[model samples]
Target: MPTFPAQPSPANKSIALCVLFPVFFLAILVSHFTLLRLPYFWDEGGYYVPAALDFFRTGTLIPQSTVTNAHPPLPTIVMAGWWKIFGFHILATRVLVCLFAAAALLAVFRLTRTLLGEKAAWVATLLTAIYPVWFAQSTLAHADIFAAAFTLWAIALYLEPSEDRPQLKVAALFSLAALSKETAIVTPLALAIYELSLALRASRNRAVPKIPATKHLKSFAALSAPVLPLLTWYGYHRFKTGFIFGNPEFLRYNATANLSAYRIFLCLYHRIVHLTLHMNMFVAVACAIAAILMPAIAPRARLSHPVVTAISVILAANLLEFSILGGALLTRYLLPMYPLVILICVAIWQSHMARLQWFWLAGLTAVAFLAGIWINPPYAFAPEDNLTYRDMIVVHQQAIDFLQAHYPEATVLTAWPAAAEISRPDLGYTTHPYKFVAIENFSLIQIQRAASDPSGYDTALLFATKWAPPQNALSLSRHNSANDAKYFDFHLDLLPNEAAAILHGEVVWKTSRGGEWAAILHFPRIVDARLNPPR
Candidate 1:
């Protein structure tokens, strides 16, 4: 195994952490300044913000407004507590999430510095901070960033020198991570299994002499400790909700429905692509792969054997666990893993390239990542993956504004999250709630169904619910009536004009940006004076 510089002194480490965190937070806040007060987008409006609002208003762990997903309450608790102090504003919510992102970056820096060196740490942390998913997620009130921060801290502690390692602290951090997001339990669980394997190997082979087999057993015990709290959360959830995981639909969508063998296989392929290629991650991955073919120029540039083994275990476990679990193959679910991937890539670059060459390579990788934040890929993806989410919010806000200004009394037919946006002022879309008739989406079939009852609503709000890039590769391969409806929750949305024609309405206002679009339709209807008389 190769070695790097000595770890920084305790005082120096403290100073560095203090400096790095604010710098990271400032960078994130400045980058997201325009987005800070924008209305919640997609799942934020659909679930997280509502769940947190329920807690803020009622002091309940289980959300009353949204369908309870049995996600742990740490994010809701934090958001509610922050709202208590800051008075429940979108800017406050976004700033709190940005703090979590900065903490995660600080953990990344510490972990990389300990394992490699300061220079590698700087490069890895910078890359992670600007990586499209991390950048986009930084200001979003989602549990993933909360979980990623604690999980990275736990991993950093776990990777510390054995003499300085704090087993209880690591277990506590892992528990906090699991509390932040249930799926985050997978990390400590994976590590526990790794420790158990090591203990078994150590007991069987006497040649392995550094730490006793008993120490590995102790490590396993610490890692397994997080499971207890997670189970307690589920038990409490069952007691309250009569369900262990979540409501039936939540369980079926996230777990049971995802159990098919073919779907798991397909998901594994997508997971691999998500980790290696999504959002221009392929640039760094490709650079690292090419560097692997070259001779080592710096003996101290490699990660220690144990560090490599631990990272491999984590990567494999998360890849397989997430492949078999999540209904949506969201990149944000694997947030902590990106920093590790980038660290390894940086280490590989340091090992083979000259200083100037490594600088150029890192610079190119950063440029690619920055470009990815603005450029939509030519495939189907969640708009939340990049700045496209801002477009979604802007266009939706425009449509809602049109409705507010011109047809405030019209019952607007629309789909979530527009449904949620127009109905919830707390989400930052409107001052007063609008009367909305909700549908699943603006798909042709759904619109046709809504058209059947024209008397129910006088206006329609429509949007592109899914990204359908021209010549979308994934759409070509994966989109079929059965598979899309069953697996992807996907449908082809009618254009605003087509939808209005079917609904016997005219398009009143519409807007489009970055392949995302939203429109409002107005229907003329006779008013019954006796039923709805002027005041």
Candidate 2:
């Protein structure tokens, strides 16, 4: 592997960055297109969809009020603007996300160099360029890409010298960051701690006079600039949901869905142990550990290193206690923090930037990139553990297209999870535009009971991994109608090696004597093809 130059030279820095920037962008572009556009990630459907709702109806950039994706105003705000250009194509959404990813990369580059020397910055940027978890998300329509940028930018500013106007910029960017996502709310708190540390350091400077009481009060107040927007969000959420944060629905859902404490600790330990086994990734993880340990190992000199300071701040901001932070440990979830992680690696290496040391660091980064591709980090959920990106998107698309071609005018129903996979036409759910009903309404026992009942509808389509017919559904006219119930199944392979067992054919059930369910299951449905995609 090629090595970072032994001595940090400004010219070398420029050349290295010049060579790196294009490579990074190309990786991003290729991943974005090659992933078959990965059509609207699940989170995109749930959160970002509503952000575009206002613009879809009013044709305005500032979308009308919505309940979902309510935390971040900027991404929704940007999405609203793009909705006009593409008029609602999923491609357009991907384009916006790609653009944001590029911009986020630039931010990483800038902050990387600012903290680490130029060589370390290049190493960090290069590693970030190829991190699969981050790469996967950079291609989607989720707001996290932009949210990560805003959050990182806020952290960057706070870490810069106080007199450089970074404090004020930190305040502004921190607000923008917080407004981007609930995860980003950590930005301001992180900034406040770092700024407080800076203030304390300044106060103890012998040459600098003690901060006067009034000045100290004023300084503290200035640090609070980011609080306004956050407080506004809080007040609005309080009035709307009777909660301080936005969208009480998510909390309720998470409370029921997410794993509890004992499980949480187990998951954390599992991930830590899981990552530890991967040689290449473990190297990067080791760097992260060293970066954390450095400040304590040699506090005086470590504090002097701007790069060390930057990495420390990022780690503190991101590595929340296991009790509070919960997620599937997606690389993108930590992507906003990868640049810092990379810098930490560089910081550990830079303190010993011999020619051989540079070579070793470069080799390890390359190993990480290779492992990233080899393991195929599970950024997006996979139905089968080993399912590839092409399998997930391309094969899934075919199943949808097949459905549309075969049942042009029929309502299609899927099991709980599979239902999400095919809720719309653009996503390739095909068939005619039929009303979407949640499969969660039925339990296993109920499904079997419904399966036994013959006096229902004539034919119903089932789409899912596990096929269980719902007994008493709104779409069923009568609970036990002695009607024909034909179970047709579609066997599809998203990839040659991996096949999706789809249960979307037809079901025969009954609705009560007279209701909406009677018409729903009985009617044939297909996409209008006239309604534009979600704007």
Which TM-score value belongs to model 1? 0.94
Candidate 2 to native Cα RMSD, angstroms: 11.8
Error of 2 at 439 (Å): 2.6
lDDT of 2 by residue, 314-391 (tens): 555555532245434333445576666665566666654454755586677677665655354322222221123334
Best by lDDT: 1
- Candidate 1 lDDT by residue in tens digits, 1-535: 1112344444434446887789989988998899899888878888999999999999889999999999999999999999999988888999999999999999999998877677778899999999998899998988999999999999998988555468899999999999999999999999999888878877898685556678888889999999999999999999999999999999998999899888888778878888899889999999999988988884555686778888998999899998899888788899999998998899889888887888788999999999999997766788877888999999888888888899877788999889899988888888788888889988888998998888888888899988867553444334444665666686778999999888888987888988889998889998776775689
Each candidate structure's TM-score, on Cα atoms with residue i matched to residue i, is 0.94, 0.69
| Candidate 1 clash pair list | none
Summed over model 2, clashes come to 40
Please report, in order, the local distance difference test score of every candidate based on alpha carbons: 0.86, 0.50
RMSD of 1: 2.9
